[model samples]
Target: MVEVTPPEGSQVVIEMWSDLGCPWCYVAKHRLRAAIAQRPDADRFKIVIRSFQLDPRAPRKPEKNEQAFIRAHGGTAAQVFQAERQMQAIAREEGLEFSLDRLHANTFDLHRVVRYANDDGRGFEFFSNVQDGFFAGALNPYVPDALEGVAEAVGLSGHRVREILASNEYADRVRADRAEGLELGATGVPFVVFDRRVAAPGAQKVPGYGRLLEHVAGPVPSERVS
Candidate 1:
């Protein structure tokens, strides 16, 4: 029952539900950004990054690599490996480098920290930084030091971040975000709602996002009839 309102003067408010560890969510974000950039009134759009956990039961420690995680989750070795390769190719198309060797872990704490950042208007930036670091294989976010490094990179207070992680700060917001998304009919990550009017599911292509934006916000002034 959380209320979502567009920022002042914004023509469109884009709320996206995605997990930090989901590869398709990463790609979908990039595509959405690309679509926004292509718009003449790009600055009129406000994006809110909603939280979702692909696996709430995941371990806090990096106990297994991507392959092992997939296999343990019921995917065959051949299917998992092939899917990883395909994902890599798809990610590359979105200007991201993917290395599926990274370890899997629960993202609840990460979501908590990001929710804290949302209060300061740095949530999306912080989330993107962590995802970039994780997917690049440059760091394991499950580790406190690595998580702190990303927070610092995003200009977040290291002490504040540590304190939030030490406690359950923003935990309710994280859970509420996921709950709201589910209520809105999202069954998976990368679910997007434009101006709370058009609901789009999955990691759609760049043009697909553009179309959704246009559908909700309508054509820019230049394209409007006098």
Candidate 2:
């Protein structure tokens, strides 16, 4: 078990690189929540969700079959089914519903929408909406209607969303985030770096994450006893 004492004054910054549609990312979010809940100084943690695209060039609406997508992720049928079960169990733990059957591979538009949502003072709301659409509503967030629906659910004006989606203004921001993710050696979703010392990729479990945070928050005692 890892022992953590929150920084007394300064908040611990956790930069999370996650794709909104990634199931592992979703599970990781819940795991983080659990860690935070256990921490005595949970209130001092600040989490920033950064954008990362699993497929930068995925279609506006995924035209490929789910099996094909799964295979490309190095996912076998057995693994996929196991993930399905795990996801279901995680959703239950998080008190959320996640349906992978209706998921798609397209993420460009969704990322663009997040840009607009960030500008509209609805970043967290928009993020939740997107998460809900994918994990609960069983909606493919890349479609125009689904994207718009999330924006609306987050209280972003329809006009602002339409204008932003029509233009290329936020495209570069999203692109830059993805580029940064790549530069950070993030090859998979839910990559997190705590205090620049511990780097974990792909939805780390609670024990590992908590240990990393604790290590970052303070010095670990030397194992060698004088």
Candidate 3:
């Protein structure tokens, strides 16, 4: 497991287990960040992104369209249509774009790269950029070059990014993260633990996350009267 130490003076450490291919995880990320920004002591919170793969056996390259992929995975055609529409609406509410044309492939490599970024202290930025590119249909991360593009955009070294992708570096860290999440009772993506005490499963609304923060970390201190 990647050992993460909270920043100096950080009061709450939030560990979120999420899969990049999951739209709800993308939306939950935005909601959580929005909630954090609303707090006066936002800087006191530390967020650690954990890796989870919704489809561990998926192919490295996307061979089917989104509809076909969902259907092949046991989702009925009707269910796929309804779920995609609902998720698009929800993503819009969170100020994020969702596309039904997103690539469906194994995220193990992506997780490995994220683990490397986490160790390098650029985890969130790299993860967010990759998610944005993915859901926007602007880039296919399944391609090595596109993945390298995201790493470069996040200020990660090009050579290091290529090296990690070409080898098994950080692969064990990714697996360890997913195992830890399951041990913590995560049955799905977007599972979050606040300070390792409060366990929140699934995608929670912005205000719900706000309440959680307040409950675990206390309310923002009231501004002093002049």
What does candidate 3's lDDT look like per residue over 1-226, in tens digits?
A: 3334444446787889998888888988889999999987888887889999877888776754554456457767677778788988988877788887666878898888898888887888888888888898898888779878888878888678889899999988999999999998999999999988788999999999999887777776677799
In model 3, which range of ten residues has the least summed lDDT? 1-10
Off by over 4 Å in 3: 1-9, 65-68
List runs of model 2 lying over 4 Å from the truth.
1-7, 64-86, 89-95, 119-125, 152-155, 195-197, 218-226
Q: Specify the poorest-scoring 10-residue window by lDDT in model 1.
A: 1-10
- TM-scores, all candidates, are 0.90, 0.76, 0.91
RMSD (Å) per prediction? 3.2, 6.3, 3.4
Please, what are the lDDT tens digits per residue for candidate 1 over residues 1-226? Answer: 2435544446676888988778899899899999999988898887888999988988776655654457458867677778889999989877798987878878999999889888887888888888888888887888778778888888888888899989999988999999999999999999998887778999999889888877777654476676
Residue-level lDDT of model 2, residues 1-226, one tens digit each, is 1335554547777777778767888878778767776776676666666778887766564653356467457767677777777878877776778764655666776677777776665664577667766777566666677677767776777776677778876888888878887887888888886755567888778887787767777533335667
Pairs of residues clashing in candidate 1: none
How does candidate 2 score on lDDT?
0.71
Worst 10 residues of 2 by lDDT: 1-10
